[model samples]
Target: MTQDLFHPHRHESHPKIISRLKRANGHLAAVARMIEEGKPCLEVAQQLQAVESAVRNAKQALIHDHMDHCLEEGSLSQQRAELKAISRYL
Candidate 1:
């Protein structure tokens, strides 16, 4: 099958990224419950921190994977554009 030239390449790390996001999602929900239950500020903050870290790592993985897999096939301008797109999140 012919690969589409315009679309970015698939990153092999996507499944791992998805799994990390899923775990973060569940953690975030639990954090909300902690808030509703009037849990200690320190505990809630720690859980929030964990959720944020998980999501951040997933995002970093995706962006790095894009640079590794997708950027290799593109023109210099395309790579710069893609880098700019992802940099806003960083």
Candidate 2:
């Protein structure tokens, strides 16, 4: 949906979340490089797993931030809608 709905306040956690995502991006790039270099399957797989975990952690942090800020600011119906939308990511 909308970025404003999920990140209405751009809370303090925003920078930390961005840092996590940047790390994930770096891991993904390394994975691509490993594949291109014909690295061993197991090694590549491990790096890929790291990238996945990093991205998942970033997503979790973002959702937690959204729940903290968005839920507090909105009405009951709005909160319910936000929760429903957020659940899809989980």
Candidate 3:
């Protein structure tokens, strides 16, 4: 990936991406607390699911932003290669 592809838009979206990751971090901390507090299995599972979803959403947001702003000006081959590399997460 070209650094220029990301540098131009990084300032615009970096903060939002960081905020999302922080939210996910908080959710994970809550999950840990719930487990320590001996919460019911069902409740704990629900919170874990929420944490997982939050993390997944954050990852997807980052990937989407990268694709939109960074990949838009790239060659088709580069874009395809990047998409292929990220496809495993999908």
TM per prediction: 0.83, 0.87, 0.79
Ordered by lDDT, highest first, the candidates read 2, 1, 3
How well is each residue in 4-68 modelled by candidate 2, as lDDT tens digits?
76576577999999999988898899899999999999999998999998889889889987887
Q: How many angstroms is residue 45 displaced in model 1 relative to the true structure, after the best TM-score fit?
A: 0.7
For this target, which candidate reaches the highest TM-score against the unseen true structure? 2
The TM-score-based order of candidates, best leading, equals: 2, 1, 3
For candidate 2, which ten residues in a row score worst on lDDT? 1-10
**Per-residue error (Å), model 3, residue 1:** 1.8
lDDT (C-alpha, whole model) for all candidates: 0.85, 0.85, 0.80
Tell me the tens digit of each residue's lDDT in model 3 across 11-53.
4777887998899899889888988999998998998898888
Native-to-model Cα distance after best TM-score fit, residue 41 in candidate 2, in Å: 0.9
Looking at candidate 1, what is the lDDT of residue 59? 89
Task: Give per-model CA RMSD.
Answer: 3.8, 3.0, 2.9
Which lDDT value does model 3 have at 77?
93
Model 3 compared with the native: what TM-score?
0.79
Q: lDDT for model 1, please.
A: 0.85
**Where does candidate 1 stray beyond 4 Å?**
1-9
> Which residue pairs collide in model 2, if any?
none
Q: Please give, for residues 1-90, the per-residue lDDT of candidate 1 as tens digits.
A: 125879744657988888999999999999999999999999999999999999999988887777666766677887788778878986
